[model samples]
Target: MSAPLASLPPRRLSWQFLRLVTPYWKSANKWQVRGYTLALLLFTLAQVALAIWMNYWSRELFDALEDKSLNDLLMQVGTFVLIFILTMAVTALHMQVKRWLQLDWRRWLTAKVLDQWMTRGHHYQLQLVGGEHDNPDGRIAEDIRIVTESSIGLVHSLVYSLLIFGSFVDILLTVTGSATFPGTAFMVPGYMVILAFAYAGAGTVFGLLLGRPLITATNKLQTAEADFRFGLGRSRSNSESIALMHGEDIERQNAKTFFARLSQRWNRQTLGYLGIVSFSSGYGALLPVFPILLMAPQYIAGGMTLGVLMQAAQAFQKLTSALSWPIDNLGELAHCRASIQRVLSLYNDMQVLDEQASEPQEHRISVAQSTQHELVLRDLCIANPDGLILLEGFNQVVRRGEHVLIAGDPTVTISLFKVVAGLWPWGHGEVWLPEGPAISFLPQRPFLPHASLQSVLSYPQPAEHFTQAAMHHALECAGIAWLAPRLTELDSWDRVLPLRAQQRLGFARLFLQQPAWVFIEEATDAFDPKGEEGMMDMLYRELPNATLLTISFHTGLERHYQRKLLLNRPAQDKYLTCSTSECSLTTAPVTPVVTAAD
Candidate 1:
């Protein structure tokens, strides 16, 4: 299993978190974000001012009660009503401004991630190599959300705490006065502030020790949740096959296994939370009384008014809460760290893929566009991902308006087609194609995007590029005229259409596209002999000048082609000779005369 994200050291994790967040403040939307942020800060300051006022008001109201002054009490109550209204207005505006900033930041970040993932086929390469990024969809859809929301929340909370602490600290110092050590002459000013710091500092240390394992637990939970969701999606996508095979029990067991793993991680997370709550609950309960206890002596001795005592207690609580911010939000911090790590890992992997893709590899097959009107391969060598040679030092050339057939081992034939299409480039030698020529590739299993039938047929091109009459004509030629009337209907055509119909649709698209060159990789396998013959005839008649290159095992269609290219796995000595020097190139076996068409 891959290591959990929580395994990263604190310093590295913090750097990654900063990397993820810094881009937004530097993005194109920075000005708008700054405007919203500035508004939020202004509102925050207003709210803090109101809170300080209320803290003093509490003292005054209590003193009014103590002196039995009804007039003063009524006036204080009226002032309280006015402050409450302003507080409510500032708070509502503050929340909306903060939310706007979060939305803008999330949008920019999501777009940036998508651009990186989709560029240069990085998504495909990630799947091909099975990289560390497990679920890119989850990273974009879920992890980005967590990072944005948590980051904004953390900023808001920290700002609020700092402002409150700043507003109250001086008040606390003034109320508590100076203190002299019991047996020494050493004196400390603002001793209440000092005590609050020491107390909150201890709580922060304890919270960190107890919550150290929570990060790993949270990462595990995310992984387990993704696995469970993947299983459910797989089951749904293949429900028909499962029901037909009566494999419901097996699928149920698979689902149960995924859920069990998720439950185990969830239980571990809950246990971590239990430890946190046990300490925090008792710590929080003692806070209010602790402040009053220290100041109660002065109030009882008549050295301070009831109002002064109340004000001092409230100030102490606010100061301590600010100092204890990290302790209170330990769980959220862990969660945010995990999410930031996941997103940064994905972004970093995509960057690696993009760089690797852009760099030229010595082992890769060289492809170039030529001025000549022909397809040429010189000393072509195709290898599997494991470096096993499939085709050694192969060479072929097909000029314009020529029909050719390629027949060989199924794997070798398909790999050669992929190399020519520039999809699988990990090979040797060079491929030269006519510059600016339109080329189409038809694979064994056609891909039909989930879109309107018209859009699916025109794929990679807009539906408006072709007229209704042209679409109908192509469908009739490919022997699927029934679909011509349903051009505007939208559905999952790949799943909805039978395999034969899907292949026919591919041919229909080929007909509509009418490219100058067509490369077929056993795309007609689904058709019967008569149907194949009819489709081949239609293709020949429709685009008589278009070059055709086909890879097929069947000999029936050989008559349609003017030439054939056959691949043979020669003896070790012959293979080595071909590899070292291009002198052994031949389309025929040494001792026998054979054709791919035969």
Candidate 2:
């Protein structure tokens, strides 16, 4: 689980944020990114310089009005026009540069995240080890956008505020001068500067108190939003199954439940925003008036000119606004914080998986590569994530070109299947995979990505990699040759094709790749007995030299394999025996291998 954003100290969060973004700055495109960043900062500085010019221009225009000089007023008006044009141009350029940086940063970060999530089957392992990283699709798509765009925006505003404070503080001090105590001889220098800091500091304290609830509320709202999106996506992906099962009522109820949770979170977030919005409105309304009222005494007493008075007020507003950056941006800061924490949580969980693989524990099944041309499982014990034993003290050695059928309990066989593929590790054992090409595991319902038929057939490889003739031949062999005419057409093949056709397409892929080793988990179960026999015959005939391991509930499959391994529970009477290297039953083996050739 991820720690709540509110509980994380500012320094710790800053460190995490730095770790997240530092790579991009030092990446191959560093010079280009840095060049654009520098341009943005320069444009911002130019904006401040124009603002300073406008301040002095305002004072001159007011002084001209007091004197009733048409010529001086005209000159000041022309200066105002010039300043306005320059400000608009600078502002536009700054926005373009900032947007460029945001898009580039987002693209790089999204690619990095996608690579981490997809590489080495981390996506599958993440599911096995559950964490707060639910709906990674949303995190990758939405949260990362928010993180990049909002982070750059926040940084720009923060830097702008600091510059404004530096530029305006001096102007405010000079215009307002010092103030003496009402009854004492003590005089405070830069009285308006001191007052601005005090005002901003007090407002920040109150705003923090009012807006603290927003952090937790925003986190909950984002989570609810992701959950709702995930629910809808799952339903859409499984629309065919749901419609066939007549599960519309259940699905509709699930959607309503998801929305209800979202609504609850939305209302809580609204309540959290109420205090901050109300306080901000009042604070902003008083900003232009507060400084004038304080300095009006001197203006009325003829000690300060109208121009100086107006200048002092504007300067005071700018300085106070700069000092209040945190209070002003509390809501957006909360939003950006939530996204950052969510992204970091997912990244940390994936890192933990990497650590687990690097440092193997005694309780885990260690899978390693070997030079031998055979798959070896020694003293194997498979367990579910909950530590419940499924298969214990199992040993097997499958040489190259052997046809082996793994039968019996589906749970045990499936767990062993994943263990061999290095996707499951919740047990004690050693699995040595021969050094060769990758082992292809064809599931019962193969994944058919929404793409051209040719691309779908040659998934994880480019469609251009295979010749058209080869693709057509493979399709004909798998009985999906009718799909060859539409190979160039793109569509959701999973939805368009039936179960049998899709299963056949899976076989067509195996034919095209012609792997040395194949593991099939009910890939042909959807077929009738005759169809199943046909697929088995085609598989053996097409790949005579390839090794094969299959898991199926159907009978008569033994005739196709040289050996059959049966998974069964150990006898209760035979006590369990354990050791550091192996845990086995005192009696015979729990898994009995039958020689089909006998």
Candidate 3:
């Protein structure tokens, strides 16, 4: 399930990259995006044209100085002003166009990945089918920015280099002309052109050799950084529990461990950078002087004028610089590749999940909807993520308006609740649900988002969806009517409210939703016996005809439900070993539901 996407073979990596990027080009705004891209390209072309004009302008100014003519110098000065104005305008416009395209592409890519990550239970499923996608938040937020911005910058530079190489190669050839060795009759044509290629070729080969280590180091460093961020984020999220357990010292150690790992990777990447930088320094220092020295012999011999010699040196430098693009950008290329790999890995794993879900498996759970107003579980079996059977050979049918109490091992009951809601799929069975209204599940701990109290009550629905009176009534029924006045105040309700108050808010949502079917999992555990009884009474008072299923260990809950079912574990302490294909039913007894009449 995991592979080094950064080390993928060039052809496969290109295909993967194209697969990711092609969607935006063909999206609904393709024409507008294309127009912007076209404008950027035109600006690039304009930049190259300006560079070529400046090359000739330099020749004229240098020649005028050599000729000692005031009129020619003045004429060249006017041309210089024209070139300066045009260069400034083109450079500024090119920057704007490039930024527009980069941001637009980044926005599209971010939205696309977010949709895949959040929709249709993919977020939950991704955790179950784990792979290299550890910190999805880091990948979406930081890595996407690097991929979009660096990619555009790299591509523009590459195109500019190619254009310069093409235009300047011919100029170097013409200016250098044919050369003969001092003592020989044999002459070499366009010798400077040949020398420029050899210089750039040698630099490119050595640059890549030295840069190989950098690519590996960069990928590892990025992963370490992401892990460190994830550790911090997790600690922040569970700060309340950590504080209550007095686990701050353990958390400090964990943070130190994350940072130690990051520091080790940083040192390795620094070593990688050293080699490339040393070689680049020597190569850059020689570029300007190397061309002039070769042209020096011809200039001293009076075979070429100062104007032609200077122009020839300039042409040689431009041609070689164009060919040196790979050498100049080696580090940035490594960084960009690392980001692309992280993004592609997340995308590929999600795609694999989709593929697995589409193909049918013999022991896989199948969830279906029926027109009948009842829930049916046929030959149900529940297993944990490790393929160990927790509960098996279960069958149940709950009709509308039945109040059922489920008492069992906590793990088994929670898994059953998720199975019915279609959130846990690691079991074999058929779950036929009523088609009209969705089932509502309230877990042990309620999640209160940071928002207005009114919005908190109407979460997953608009605040305006419920009338003010209904909101107030729900609050009263849940025993938190004191919050009614603060419905408009925005705050972090989860942080400020106590566990009991948060539980009340959860029940208030159930009142607002008014679902036909409801499942509760120890949501009343925070309350005392009297408070729990009052909450139960309030539920029946508000929605007497609604079908209710409660999973709890509280003593008096049995009195509220007409039927009681007890889940019994086997005497054996070991888990039932089984594979998906040949899963055998566990003999763990499940006591049949007994009616209150019995």
Each candidate: RMSD to true structure?
A: 4.7, 3.0, 2.8
Model 1 TM-score is 0.88
What's model 2's TM-score? Answer: 0.94
Top candidate on lDDT is: 2
User: lDDT of candidate 3?
Assistant: 0.85
lDDT of 1 by residue, 1-598 (tens): 1244456788977887677678777777678777888898899889889989999999999999999999999999999999999989998998899888877888888998989888755666566554458778888888888888888899888998999988899899888887666689998888888888888888889988887778779888988898898888889877767878999999999999999999999999998888778889988998998888977776887868999989999999999999889989888988887778778878888776554444454446777788999999887766654445567767777899899998867777887787777766555678898766657899997889999999999997999999999999999988899998899999989777877899999999988988899999898898899989988999999889999999998989989999888775434322212232232323432321225442
Candidate achieving the largest TM-score? 2
Higher-scoring candidate on TM-score, 2 or 3: 2
Model 2 clash tally, residue pairs: 0
Model 2: pairs clashing at backbone N, Cα or C within 3 Å: none
- lDDT, candidate 1, residue 123? 68
- Tens digits of per-residue lDDT for model 2 on 374-407? 9999888776665556777777899999998888
What digit string (tens of lDDT, one per residue) describes model 3 on residues 368-464? Answer: 8988999998877677755666666678888999998988677778888888877777767788997688888898887788899999999888999
TM-score of each: 0.88, 0.94, 0.93
